[model samples]
Target: MSSKALEQFLDENIEDLKSRGLYNEIDIVEGANGPTIQIGGRELINLSSNNYLGLATNNTLKQVANEAVASHGVGAGAVRTINGTLDLHKELERKIAAFKGTEAAISYQSGFNCNMAAISAVMDRNDAILSDELNHASIIDGCRLSKAKIIRVNHSDMDDLRKKAKEAVESGQYNKVMVITDGVFSMDGDIAKLPEIVEIAEEFDLITYVDDAHGSGVLGNGAGTVKHFGLQDKVDFQIGTLSKAIGVVGGYVAGKKNLIDWLKVASRPFLFSTAVTPADAAASAKAIDMLMESNELVQLLWENADYLKAGLKDKGFDIGNSETPITPVIIGDEQLTQKFSKRLFESGVYAKSIVFPTVPRGTGRVRNMPTAAHTKEMLDQAIATYEKIGKEMGMI
Candidate 1:
């Protein structure tokens, strides 16, 4: 293509994004994403990270990573199926399988890649996938890549799921049927009705896939959503991320040994992309070990979430129906929501606005992620900032 044509295309896309107020201007963080982060030389109370158990900066994990780096160097050098399957990678997979109560597990470069790999590996154009409407974008992409007929069921609406699943199976047009959902919807912080989903899947013989990216470190006393609901054996795929609660980097799918074996040979990312670093793998193993050792961090995280949610609710902010630590202070208009976030940042709070297409338009809001590392005083400060900005912007 000509340079002018390419430039025109880029300009038009940028203009479209600007027109929709969905263009995200990157903000550089000068320090680690802790309870307080330094951005633009200003310290802000950070509430937009997925570090639920606060392990991202934990000293123990840091030490583990350092040790692994010293021993194995930084990069894996090749793909896992190539010469990249380090002992650290195997160890991390073993640890993850144990943590998730699965026979085996397979790691990928990212949680997003896990979805991209697993979904397409199992389903295809001859299959049909019943996905929750509010599932993560990665899941949507995965389904699309699978070439499967995508059926979007209402979020947590079992009736719609059941109807769709039954119709798809009864038609006999599909060779396989799968149901995919986010264990905890990141946008709403609502837990998936896994028990109901499992029951439905069993009745219809539908394959179950749960992307527990948000629930892995925050739920099941850190065992994850499958264990939380006692559906470990029932769920076919338990997808999780090391970058979230684990405070490292990478993603994995925990399931039957045969499923993992198939993925090792079939998943495109595993076959074509390089493996995760030894340091990240080692640190993630250590993080899982910590979560299994005690509930102190998980409990503390819940307490912090409760405290922040209660304070926001008391202040008359429409803190949406969040059963987990992920909370959203709902503000309708996109521009107003962005302004609200900007004002919060100015006041030393780091909550970010969620707008289309990360979320539906007109449901724009600031999403808060309270971690175990946050003190009550810190939450109080955030609450005070919210109150001030909320009233000033007429959001409350």
Candidate 2:
């Protein structure tokens, strides 16, 4: 038998969660996650993936990935500090630097790992970080790992950021101060007030960091949020993911040459973790090259997002104040949100319901991700299904 104490603890906690209607049941996707997917043998109009540019299923990416696998085999042979650093890794970093308009760049195993590696690498107990209250979980964990004094700034509130930054600096309680935020908040699809944040950072000489995981391929003509505000030369750290818009599997930090060089030597993950597969590096480089060549896919993504947002709003759904492609249909109650998601699944839509503690309690919502791969007909069908269910459930 398994450890009885461990089993009892899990059973009690799981039962408590179930009684409170907060238990989550995971579903398995049966096929490739494209504009549509199959789960439990039912095809669904998929709106849950982060494949914003639909590059995850792109033929060109697949071709290049296969070619890379054929040439380099399946994996990097060792940790980066050892012999795992291949020419493909160098090429991908070069492409990332050029795409982000940075002097240099470093790739990580994943976006979450980028944060985990980057933050603690620079910060320590003597440092203090002023972080946005609604920052991603990775950012939160990274801050905690640094053992820095963390001060929470109100979401997108410049005044709060300014006040906190002034206090953190003037207190002289720390050797260094940094401010970090997400370029595009994943939950509400709201854009960060980057220009103001930069101004504050400049005033206080605080290190600036922006995790533009969602904004990288969707904003600033696919460059990212820092570039969107024309501040590429200003921000100290520009973090992004290859998995989302790039349609591959990894993360990167685009910054000055010195910063990139330091991360290569100082970051624990980069030092100890094996590099990304040769296929992933090659495919991601190809994706960035494609994005740099044209704006067609980005345009199509925004068009689809506008169509879906307009459709949901016209139907009287509480689709929050989103500034990007992530559309959240607020349902308020937790159990109702889960039930609504199930109803949507039954009706052939695959948008997932997000609730506490992922979001604030009572603001439960179903997030819809409209990718460039989705056609008007598919979006229309999803809209119609949402309307049917919304009316039937008295939510509209």
The predictions' CA RMSDs to the true structure, in order, are: 1.1, 0.8
Estimate candidate 2's RMSD in Å: 0.8
Evaluated at residue 279, the lDDT of candidate 2 is: 96
Candidate 2 per-residue C-alpha lDDT over 1-396 given as tens digits, one digit per residue, 9 for 90 to 100: 799999999999999878766888988988798999999999999999999999999999999999999999999999988999999999999999999999999999999999999999999999999999999999999999999999999999999999999999999999999999999999999999999999999999999999999999999999999999999999999999999999999999999999999999999999999999999999999999999999999999999999999999999999999999999999889899999999999999999989998999999999999999999999999999999999999887
Off by over 4 Å in 1: none
Q: What number of clashing residue pairs does each candidate have, in the order they appear?
A: 0, 0
The stretch of ten residues in a row with the least summed lDDT in candidate 1 is 387-396
lDDT by residue (328-374, candidate 1, tens digit) is 99988898888889899889999999999999989998999999999
